[model samples]
Target: MKTEIIWMIIGMGAVTYIPRMLPFVLFRGKELPIFLQGVLKNVPFATLGALIFPGILLIQEDIWYGILGAGAAFLTAYLGANVIVVVLSSIAVLTLYSYFV
Candidate 1:
């Protein structure tokens, strides 16, 4: 059982390492196109929104909680605030909302 767990961990490590290593190895001497670079830069933001969107719609007790929090986050982010500020603003909005109602 211990051996199996060890082997599973090793296998998982290799599976993760290969995909990460391949990009560096294959792109060592080449530069990505300008359009591709721009798209890649935005990937994290797009992925964050994709991950958060569903949770916003699935709020159980009150849908307004999610909608208000999301709105606060969006407004903060739209004003050029960084990720921490965006998240903090959202939390503050929700806290106040919860306190009042």
Candidate 2:
């Protein structure tokens, strides 16, 4: 049982690592097309929105909490902040909301 679990873990790791690493290995020197580059550049923002939108709609206690955080995230992202900064700003807004309300 333990050996099977270990093998499963190894398989999962390889499944994840290969797709990520394969691109770098295969496209080391090539420049992707401009259209593709533009699309790729927006991937993080799109991903963040996809992940957060559902949570915003699903907040049980008060929708205000989700609204505040989402607004902060949107504003920061619009200002071209890093994804980490956008997330942290949203967290800061929510933390403040929790503290006061």
Specify the highest-lDDT model's number: 1
lDDT tens per residue, model 2, 1-101:
69999999999999999998997888853398888888888999999779877877566578788778878988999999999999899889888989998
For candidate 2, the per-residue lDDT at 23 reads 78
**Cα lDDT, all candidates:** 0.88, 0.86
Q: Each model's RMSD to truth, in Å?
A: 3.5, 4.0
Which ranges of candidate 1 are over 4 A from the true structure? 29-49, 59-62, 98-101
lDDT of 1 by residue, 4-99 (tens): 999999999999999989977888533898888888889999998899988885775688998898889889999999999998889898999999
Which candidate should be chosen as best, given TM-score against the real structure? 1
> If scored against the real structure, what TM-score would every candidate get?
0.61, 0.57
What is the lDDT for 90 in model 2?
88
Per-candidate clashes come to: 0, 0
Candidate 2 lDDT (Cα, 0 to 1): 0.86
